[model samples]
Target: MSSTDPDVDHALAYPEPPASPLWHRQGAKARPLTDAQKQRNCELLLLAQHKPRTHRRAEKPACSPT
Candidate 1:
C-alpha cells in the first residue's frame, strides 16, 4: 500500500506505544495519612490561621532639595 494513500488504515499501520511507567500514571489511589501526619497538618493549619497579615506601603517619589 502507498504511504501517501488516503484509503490507508493509519490505526492498523503503526504499532501501539508502550504503557507509561507506574509513577507517570495519574489518578492512582492515595494512601491514608498516618495519625502523626494528620496531627502535624492540623497544628500547621492552626499556626497559619493565627499568623498576622502584612500590608505593603505605596512607594513615594524622591524629592529634590532646592
Candidate 2:
C-alpha cells in the first residue's frame, strides 16, 4: 500500500511508441547550384541587406465624437 512501491510503478509504466514511417524516409538529393545561380543569389542578398525599411504609423479612429 506504500506510495514508493516499485511493483505499482512498473505496472503503470508504458513502453515508448515507435517513430512514424516518415521519420526514416529520405527525400530527393539536392543538386549543386550553378555559377550563374550563385551570382544571382549574392546580388539578391546584397539588395535585401541595403533595402530601406519603412515604419507604419497608426491613424486616428475615423468616426470619433467631436
Candidate 3:
C-alpha cells in the first residue's frame, strides 16, 4: 500500500530525458549528409512508416536482474 514499493514508482525511478536523434554532440557533426545518405534516410523513414507500434499488453512482471 506504500508508494515506496517498486511497483508503485518503477517508471519514475532514474527516469532519463529523451534523446534527440538529431543534434547530438558525441558524434562528429554528421558531415553534410551525402545524396546517398539522404536517399537512405528517406527510404528508411518510408519503411518505418509501415511497422506497427509496440506496447506492453500485460503488466511487465517486475525484473530483478542485477
Candidate 4:
C-alpha cells in the first residue's frame, strides 16, 4: 500500500494519458485563388479526367531500326 513500494499493485497505477490534440486551436481561413490560377487548375483537372489511355503491345519482339 506504500507509494514507494518496490512492487506496486496493478490497479493503483494511473491510467494511460489521453491522446494529444490533432488540430490547431486557432480558426482557419480560406483564401480565394487568383483568376489565372483558377483557370489553370480547371484546365488541369479537366485534362486529368478526360485523358486518353491506350495499351499497345507488339505480337513479337520489336525490330531494331537501321
Query: Against the true structure, whose lDDT is highest?
Result: 1
| 1-66: candidate 2 lDDT, tens digit per residue | 676766543553677788989777588877988877776666555555553742432243232222
After superposition, which runs of candidate 1 have C-alpha atoms over 4 Å from their true positions? 1-27, 53-66
Inter-residue clash pairs, candidate 1:
none
What are the per-model C-alpha RMSD values against the true structure?
16.8, 16.2, 18.9, 16.8
Question: Which stretch of 10 consecutive residues in model 1 shows the poorest summed lDDT?
Answer: 57-66
- Report the number of the highest-TM-score candidate: 2
Q: Per-prediction TM-score, please? A: 0.37, 0.40, 0.33, 0.36
For all candidates in order, the CA lDDT equals 0.57, 0.56, 0.55, 0.56
Q: How much is the lDDT of residue 39 in candidate 3?
A: 64
Q: Give the Å error, residue 62, model 3.
A: 43
Clashing pairs in 4: none
- How many steric clashes does model 4 contain? 0
Local accuracy of candidate 4 as per-residue lDDT tens digits, 1-66: 686777855784678877677654557777788776776666555555543743443234333222
Question: What is the lDDT for 53 in model 4?
Answer: 43
Candidate ranking (TM-score, best to worst):
2, 1, 4, 3
